[model samples]
Target: MPIDIRGSSASEIADSLRALVERGGLRPGDALPPVRTLAESLGVNRNTVSAAYRQLTIAGLVVTLGRGGTRIAGQAPVAQEGFADTVLRDVGTGNPDPSFIPDPSRALATIAGRPILYGEPVIDPDLERWAQEWMSADLEPASLRLTITSGAADAVERLLAQALTREDAVALEDPCFLASIHTVRMGGYRAVPVPVDEEGMTVDGLRAALAHGVRAIVCTPRAQNPTGASLSAQRAAALREVLGEHPYVLVIEDDHYSMLSRTDYHSLIGPEHRRWALVRSVSKFLGPDMCLAVTASDPETAQRLALRLTPGTTWVSHLLQRLAHALVTDPDARDRVDAAAEHYAARNAAFAELLTAAGIPVRAQDGLNLWVTLPVPARAVSEQLMRRGWLARTGDEFDLVPAGPSHRLRLTVHDLSDDDAGQLAADIAASVRAVA
Candidate 1:
């Protein structure tokens, strides 16, 4: 059998090769037919084939060798002509796996009414009541009040608006959530650094930041993003001890992974605190498209956050509230959500085991991703992984305000099979070796 290359221009030849790739004929690293033979079969000049090969090489579709032959490139970037590219396998961000997001089509079909109008209470009645109960249970206090927001980021933004003004200093865990880092920078407020370790944000770091005049703080109590670190009871107590005198500074606990979290939640905001909040977004467990998060805060801060979430300005859609309530209350979706949580935990642990076997240490205490302590620079490791048919994200992206030097990586293995995890581990070992 012969490949039929029929008088195709360079672009046409490229498209044909791309189709071959999609159809699985030209697998990663598989050699293409010789240029001369392809040219003769297509009844075209050799330069036409040559041009096609050159463009493909530049485009990363094929790789040329001295004599072994030009082969289909492995782990090429998805061509970005116009469409938005998905950041696949990067696991750098704290996004849930596609397989884990609940199918909302069925739920959407059940909504049988007109679209909502502004100036009305934007949350479904049943959902509003249910969310209040859940928040009350999770963050029990005498002055607790609930306010629904679009999502975690929206909650953070609104909280910031109510709590601070331009140039106000806020303490943040060093290498905090990326959105938190960006939010502080974009809002023109100063971000004071509070270091985090295996236990979580350090007491010394917090005290230092507070001493420097920080008025607000964002703390991830469980499953802190990127690092997968959580505040332990001992660390939380120590933090509380240090903050005993600093009761005026507002604390926002972004427990984004609350329900899906593998660890118990701990808060630095003691029972005596006059002002604080606990925010949990349904995006992770209930599907990011759910676009809803509930914030529990003291009455004073809650009133402020509610004011920020004003009727038409930023109220979360009531329809989304209904869907969330329906799905969460449904036994089937609740069970599925629980199973998904366990699945992600098991997958991330398994991936960490493989990494350990490959001699690269990593672990995840409570989050969907593993915090890998690479033996070398993460950028070097990531670049090498790209060569081995994998693209991993570097840790630098999440550093709130990166300090001296750090060599680490945050990888999500939610959708990775055991086979892919093993291959990824092997690549990581090889990448580390190359960097060494």
Candidate 2:
């Protein structure tokens, strides 16, 4: 059956197509008529049909495959960064151990104050001052402006939205953070895969992405997700040199694991770089419920980002901001945070030893999880582990561009007991051999 695309105006046509999707008249993978065919049938101009298609694509209702034509988007669920719902032991959950997170009770008591009214400053003054000093240590003494958002993910989404329009190309790390992938796809932006190696985004991969005409780049400077790769000083300098050719490209460095990361920060932003933002969130140390992140960016980018974050409507709550500041500033809470970093590193290191002893040679890196390379395909070993009551996240789930079968597994084993960790290591070794 043909799609009855009925309407004279762009808005009307978009509404008509949306209705078809809502009513199940058009299903996922169902292709819409060509622009000329739809325009001729509806007695409208080709521009009107094109506008309608653009509207649907931006709304994530349809996908344009260029010469292949537009089709209804499948709406597949994007994988998240937290715990997975499972009865089995979930080693794939990219979560900080609860015991390590600092207690918020003391800070909560100190945050009570007069209710903030609309039109008052968006960011808490104390928080703003502290954040400036914190970010300044890592950044050059340029004209830096600060903006606070709900979290690092929210900051990235808004930063990209302010910088680029729909279909604009963005350079993303291949095997990227799940949230970044979802944000780019939902905004209808093209993601140019920049491969990440042990030292972070490869210089050649970044050059290729730039050559592909990417308008923006999102990279994790330290403790990169899944792979736990950090940019070494040498690699960071090389990346900065490559980016020098495209100084105006919007570079967003999501330093999400800021406080908890054991590695030193190696910045990709050069002293003379024109556009960039470094985002650090309080979620990892203060607990995920403390939804706040501080972003330091070039003055102009900060101004553009502020447009989306209004005084009262969209600005992050001042109370939350104060709470985060109090916790971070307190000596006891700061000590707890430092301990948490050490705790995570030690746990991961111990687990790596366990894996090595079990016949699978492994080395621990930064971040809360271990990115293990298996002798066999990760999916096959994952399946074998599933039979032994364990849930695992394979490397393919994070791949921006599907290569062949992935041989890596991202395991969150930091919170497991010593016995459990040893058992899991042995089980993983068995699973690899079983699937080999």
Candidate 3:
């Protein structure tokens, strides 16, 4: 057969050619028909046919050997330009809106400690007692134990180090927090991406991951990155059901936005699930520089994690811990922090509303940012925004699987003033339209 090439446009024709290649009819060295003949046969304009052919050539799927006609190449198409160290922006990162974080002066007032001698335990007893209380909220099970660490990122690294080997597969949300993905690459581990949905990690994706023999999973149950999808209570229960049968799999829950999260905690770790850790970092609400995360896990796993902490880096900063404890426990600080969480949620929602009003689709469940769908490629839109004097991160940078052209963009709406947000909305609308 001459390869079925019926499709809507130039891109579709290119896709049809790829399909032929996949079906084995268009193997290496298989020369395609002349452009004019193919265009006539398909009832499309010759320029449309030419564009498709050019695209296929660019993809390396076909090569025009001078007048010898186009032949399938040994390789496939090259991926178009991808994330090149995405620019830091006023948008994208899911950090707490700084205005809401309470400045804790009391911790500094009590800060007085000499360098510890060798073999000294790392954590402060006072902080430990308070952490036990602080951690109790997220990890409600009495059997679960708690340990302090530098941050949620640190906790993830140490847990992965303890459980998996070099190059072992670990499942993570495809558009996960960059840190977790970076942790996998930096630790020389292969990442098995589980697709996320509006309710966070999909069950089928999880099943595929388990079947793929992923020994570790890093999930952010609530406030998942990029997409801002939180796992529903029912979804959490379903995941726990699947995980229950896999006792040996190490589940790490990174609740990085704990204090700033306006959602309830949900866990895929069943009551009987043996190995798991719920990492709640105070860095978000308390401030990133605070650098302390409460790592709560099962007693045995917590002890193993403690061993990783060791005598040298024995525990988290006692000063940081004390600060976290004081701030979390203080009524005024707690109120301010809660208000900050609400502030982030409100700002994101308002921005999403503004975008929608401007004909740009957007929705974010509960997070420091909003996921927006534009009318054209988000990367192009972000580049335009950069020219407009606002740096923005392209969502493609955080996605694991390659997404075809999309208008999706993640906007960190927190910290934007009314005027700034209005201006951003107007600019973004103009940019998307310009690209489209």
Candidate 4:
């Protein structure tokens, strides 16, 4: 079906396209007419058509695939949780152990009042006061402003929407976070892969990405997903040096595992850097259901983020904010959260040790999961594991660049007991050997 934008402005055109997508007229992968062609047909300037296309792209309604033309953005794959099977030993689900999650009963009791209405302050005062101190301690001495979003993913989505255009290159860690990959692809932005090692994101990889004129860079500072890598101070300094040359490019540090992480916060943003946002989500520490994250950023970036999250627009729930505040500020709850962090570290470390004993070396320095490299392809090993009643996630699923050989697997078996861990490790080694 052809798009009919006879007397429409850029916004109207974009709205029409969005409606088309909703009505199933424009399906995913369906190509749109060229900007020049559409402009000529609609009797509008080419810039107007381009602007409309840009709006659709930012809204994740369409993608501008160079040479191949504009098309509807493909749907992002959902991250899988534990398998709902009684028999399968589910280790693939990237979830924190349920026992570690603090019970919010007491925190719920502490939350008072419900006079929240439109035009009120978006962030809860109590939450803001506590979050300000929390974010301030981790950040370099600078004029930082804070904004609350639904989660780290929400913060990332809003930041990119405000800062970038369709087809703009955004740097991502090679073995990227599923949410980050999904958000970038769904937004119709180009994702440039930056390699990550045990020391976190490589400097040369970032330098190369910057050289290619990436508009933004999204990095996981510690406990990087699919690899469990953390940025050492030396690595952070090196990355900061590379980023110093490109200070204008937006730098987004997703410190998602902040409290749960065993490592210190090694920042990629230097003090002099202009556009940057440090996002810390309580999802890992506080339960995922809390759905709140604090984004500490430069005044300008914070202001732009605020614009997207105005009073009635996209503000996070004040009740939830108050609850999160209660948990973080309450002495007993804070201690429980601290203990939960240590629990995850100990469990993951223990599992990694087991894998090593089984002769299948794993590097799980921090975080809830281990990233183990197999001598054989991950897919074949995953199939073998399934036969042995174990479900595991293949590293290929997390690769930013598809079409490459993948030999790694991400396992979240932190809750497994000594016997279970040993058996699983043995099974994994056997699977790899069988596949090879």
TM-score: which candidate is best?
2
The lDDT per prediction is 0.79, 0.91, 0.79, 0.86
Spell out the clash pairs found in candidate 2.
none
**Model 3 TM-score, all chains together:** 0.77
The global Cα lDDT (0 to 1) of model 3 is: 0.79
Tens digits of per-residue lDDT, candidate 1, 87-123, equal 4455455568767667777877776567777666666
RMSD of each: 15.7, 3.2, 12.1, 4.5
The estimated TM-scores of all candidates read 0.77, 0.90, 0.77, 0.84
What is the number of backbone collisions in each predicted candidate, taken in the order shown? Answer: 1, 0, 1, 0
Name the regions of candidate 3 deviating beyond 4 angstroms.
1-89, 113-117, 140-142
Q: Determine the backbone clash count of candidate 4.
A: 0
Tens-digit per-residue lDDT, 1-436, candidate 3: 2667766578898888889889886789988878888888888898988878876754456778889988888853322222234444456555666677787876567666676566666676777787777667656456877788888888999999888776688999987777876777667676888998888899889989999999999999888877778889988988888887798899999887777788887878777778889898887788888888888898888888888878446866666776677777789998998888888888888888888899987775766677776768888998899878676666676776666855677777678889999999988998988888
When sorted by lDDT, best at the front, the candidate numbers are 2, 4, 3, 1
Give candidate 2 regions above 4 Å deviation: 6-19, 29-73, 311-313
